[model samples]
Target: MMTEQRVELAVTKSELGARLQTSESQVAELKRENEAQAVDLSAMEDRSNSTELQLQEHKTVMEELKSTVEGLKGHIAERPKVAFSAALTDAGSVGPFNTDITLIYTKVITNIGNHYSPATGIFTAPMRGVYYFTFICHNYGANIRFGSLLYKNGERIVSMTDWQTSTDHDDNGSNAAVLQLEVGIRSTCVSHLTARSMMTVIITAPSAASCSSPCEQKTLQHLQRLPALPHVSRRPCSTFSGFLLFPM
Candidate 1:
């Protein structure tokens, strides 16, 4: 009986040792899992911080862009207004040509704004604005077919047709247009008339205080040489004129 009891007590002690070993291993596994979770959470926090900084930088850049845009708008608004007027003096007998030709004006009545170029017969807009333009052609030759056109760039925008007056009377007419012109825009007058006819064209527009291009100075220099002749004509005369109506 004593030997059986001693055997039972030894078995019980061995079983208790095994249970303790299992508990110790489970505790070590739990500790390792907690350490891995901590590392993962720390990495997630770092990424979130970087993303927030980038967002802040982008916002700053957007604000700067907005400011620059506003400044440009203000500068454009402050640009000067534009106005010009011109008229033609005696362009001796023109166009005895076999084919159609463009007449160039050598005389100008007024070029207050300096936008009109007598050299090229083109009016360049100094700024974007609504403008009024008028062109008149008077021919003193019977049996003459006289016509005029207003051109934008190289294309014909409008045409003023020829009017035949009675025998021994001058054939004269005028055409006018109100244009919404743009900055850096160009316009001109061209004439197609019969041979040996004395025709005069006149152009007029309101003058602006300042122009946006350096051509304004050249306009002044040319204006100085233009002989201030009296247009004391009882008969119809040719004229061209324009002015800024308003800005767009």
Candidate 2:
């Protein structure tokens, strides 16, 4: 009986040792897995920080873009609307005298912004915008060349010429233009004329006064519609007019 017991005890001790070895192997594997997980967690944290930085940069750029757009909106809103036009009021005429002179429109048919002065024969811009101008001219068939020009800021933009080609007929012509004008820019109609007696023209406005060139003279810009006419003058013949299309 004592021998049998010793053999059983030895067997039991052997089994216990095998179990401890298996447990140690499993512990070692668990330790290695834990270390790898720690490494992965550190890398993930770095990536998370980088992603956060990118988000912050994007947010800053968006903010700047928003500010620029707002500034543009404000600028557009601040721009003003402007328009104006004028024409003849009565019958009139200028020179048969041989002299180049600017036509001053003393009578105003319409001055929307009061920017055009019949006295100066010029339209002064109140705001930056695109403008349209028109002029009509006529002459007494007194063997004279009837001519007119559109002037912008003292520069010639266009003109109309009507020569009494037929002694039996009165001469007439018209011209137009579209101009981009800024504040302080002035526009007017200049009359180019040849010798004759009285000339009469009509429209929303006048015929023209002869103008001298380089086209820059300030006062000699436009013409009067109604001539300070002679008794039985051709009633009304031409017009000088303009209007704003939109703000530039």
lDDT (tens digit, per residue) of candidate 1 on 1-248: 99999999899888888988888888888888888888988998898898899889899999998999899889767755566655543533333333333334446666756877878666777878888777665544334444555544343445544434446435456666677766766655544323433222222233321111100000011112321212313322555567778777
RMSD of each: 13.7, 9.4
Model 2 spans with C-alpha error above 4 angstroms: 1-81, 88-92, 151-156, 194-235
CA lDDT of every candidate: 0.52, 0.54
lDDT of 2 by residue, 147-244 (tens): 55555434455655544443434555667777776667666554443333222221112222112111111111123322222111333455566777
Work out the TM-score per prediction: 0.46, 0.49
- TM-score quality measure for candidate 2: 0.49
Alpha carbon lDDT at 99, candidate 2: 45
